[model samples]
Target: MKDKINELLERVENFRPKAVAEIEDFRVRILGRKGELTALMEEFKSVAPELKREFGQKLNELKRRAQERVAALRAEAEQAAGEASSQIADMSRPGSEEELGSRHPISLVRNQIVEVFARLGYTVADGPEIEDDWHVFSALNFPPEHPARDMQDTFFIGKNPDVLLRTHTSSIQVRTMERQQPPIRVICPGRVFRNEAISYRAHCIFHQIEGLYIDEGVSFADMKQSILYFAKEIFGEETTIRMRPSYFPFTEPSAEVDVSCNLCGGKGCNVCKGTGWLEIMGCGMVDPNVLEACGIDSKRYSGFAFGMGVERIAMLKYGVRDLRLYFENDVRFLRQFESAL
Candidate 1:
């Protein structure tokens, strides 16, 4: 029995496992219930009384050595695993590119439009999405019974007709006039809400950029030239513009502004519906009544205001057929504008 104990001690001291699984197997074979160490402990009870002390001491030392060997083998196996994992990676090679996010299509076009106007000395302006009727309609020469004031066209807050979501960014122009004196040149850009059904071309919510230039001796010609410069900058150098007489509550001698079709060099295309033209915005001289309502002296000052839908501009520029794409947060659709940024 003493010789068997000495042999087992030598085995424990030399024990080494190449892997974590072998280390666990070694532990179960020697130290587990019904294992070698447990069997040896049982055998000690049959030893003679005089020999018990010496055998007991040997058994305790063997058990201690077996436990220490198992622990060392486990640590070595873990270290080997870590080294193997580290070798799987190429430390000297270039790293994989981290994916970069991009600006939304609407934002890209909006920024481009703002940049074009910024070059012309027009400062950007903003206003609240929720507004009172006066800033949106009343102060803009909208009559009390105007159809736009109705709940069917405008989104009223709660039961109050006077407070509602702005149907257009023209509200910001009114706010600007109310606070600033003439010689005011500002471009209002923001989101507007309407009580309308959503569709590929139309939505309940949209963006608009409205420009206002008020000062002594401002004229329709100045507005036309300014718009022409903007059209050429946005579309191309050869682009041309033609205004058709139209009507708006806030602009006298109003006209809808259209640019020659860029898709077909103004010849014809399905995008322009074969008309060789595409309407872009609305513009005209500011109505005296509108100017007077906002505390601007109509007799002393005159101005022109023009407004265009930002989503519409984005669609024209990017050839996007669906207005809904701008509002949907689809990463695949938005990623198309990464290069545009």
Candidate 2:
């Protein structure tokens, strides 16, 4: 029995498992209910009383050594299994899936707006973001001394009056006029630049879609009907618009269009500032001077022009409280519109 104990101890000290299954087998052989340790413990009672102490200690030592050997074998086997797992893993298998991206909320809204107008026979016209004063302001009937042309309000280029960042998409309207004659019906959408401090309510850089409709005899009434139809189409059929007198350089007797707040349902709310209305856009009959400046026969061909801040329209449509949020590329905020897409 003593020789058997020493031999088993030597074997345990030298034992090494190459796999997890071998370690499991070793555990069951030494530690399971019917294992070698249990068999030795059952034989402990048969030893002589005088030698019982020594034999008992030997049995305990054997058990301890067996446990240690099993633990060490398990650790080695686990490490081996890990290395083997990495080597044997199916490298040909497809990698983990990557998340897909979606259209931005602002982009989705812009497309919707353009699509709505497109359905009404409007063709899209684009122009340069960096434009000259003649195309941006002067041709659009902006006075030479207008504050918009000031360096403090406009982004001037090379200290020249003829060159500057376009302050509005209406600049595209002027460009379209110079390029196309009467019977021109088009929508201009582009980025506009202004020299204003960024804030929750306003941005120095924003987007606008200005609409121009020119023919033989366009009037304020035609403009009104068109705006109303657009309002109904965009804001739902329940929408109502109120046009308040306003002013713009290119439009005579210009008006600001306000739609009944969808959020408050015309009962007044925080979004509408208790006014039950949200200003959507500014519009007016194209001043004859503007038409004449673009070389159109002002008397024979009267037209109307309307311009709206795309951000403003998006804000009103979606109840976006902060203008800065649209510019911030926060994934969480944009993900809210996932369903909106």
Candidate 3:
């Protein structure tokens, strides 16, 4: 026609396209539909009626310069692919190692027994894993036919049998001796419920910490040198402790405490099954009817209470012979305590 519309408007002003699939194959070779401008609009309907207005204005200026040269070669191929993806994107490196999370080996032995009794001043107290029956067993002296106030070992909570759940965090030391008083050096920790029977050494939900130290001349040799400086700050400095004469309707001449095994340094093994000793807690001296049922004048504030089992001191500090691997949240047994945090 007009020399094929000036050779497709000089091939659409030199259509240059390095990428975006060559600007969609140059917009399907100029607006496709059997394109070449739809075969020049069927050769301008058999051109001839007085050259149909100059080949209909040069075929609408060759279809508007083939749609503005395929929209300027698709914006210069998307700005050279966003500057080659921002020069291979190295936004100051350091990124993919992300997997951290560790704690719960019964909260790392209950925060290492509340940081070894918070460096001996104790503090931290808390209560209510749903209790009653006088802060869990008649202010700790427990006897109302005590088989741990049975319903096959307490969980009671519904038909009002004096509510239940707490089978011991000594009901947060009888709710911190019925609302603090007595220079009570606290420590209680938490989570305790027992209807029992889930084993690898028992559990129906567990955890307990308990400690109390009422003021004014507290003893049993100051609870045996504060549990032998808390068993040499948790089993080390060549630990040693002994106590034995046990019983516990809230401690009184009660005792149990063992420690001295740390796996064979006591010269025995099979994890202390060979009698190097390991028991680990339950102390004595607070029961004058559990300090007169929390009003504390049990012959004037004589104190000492102890307790353990933060998953039995995190299975004797991580030798962990399955207390159901601290409640089976097993990410390969919690990624082996991720380097013990």
TM-score of each: 0.74, 0.71, 0.38
Per-candidate RMSD vs. true structure? 7.3, 10.5, 16.6
Clashes of each: 0, 0, 0
Ranking by TM-score: 1, 2, 3
Put down candidate 1 lDDT per residue, 64-173, tens digits, no spaces. 99998888787777888799878877777898898888988888888998999999899999999999989999999988899999889999999987889999999999
* lDDT (C-alpha, whole model) for all candidates: 0.92, 0.85, 0.84
**In candidate 1, which residue ranges exceed 4 Å CA deviation?**
1-94
Residue by residue across 87-167, what tens digits does model 3's lDDT show? 877878886798988877788878887988889898998877888788888778777787878899889979998888888
Error of 1 at 5 (Å): 40
On lDDT, the leading prediction is 1
Clashing residue pairs in candidate 2 are none
Candidate 1, residue 301: the lDDT equals 96
> Model 1: how far is 284 from its true place, Å?
0.7
Task: Give model 1's TM-score versus the native structure.
Answer: 0.74
The CA root-mean-square deviation of candidate 3, after full C-alpha superposition on the true structure, stands at 16.6
Between prediction 1 and prediction 3, the one with superior TM-score is 1
**Evaluated with TM-score, which candidate comes out highest?**
1
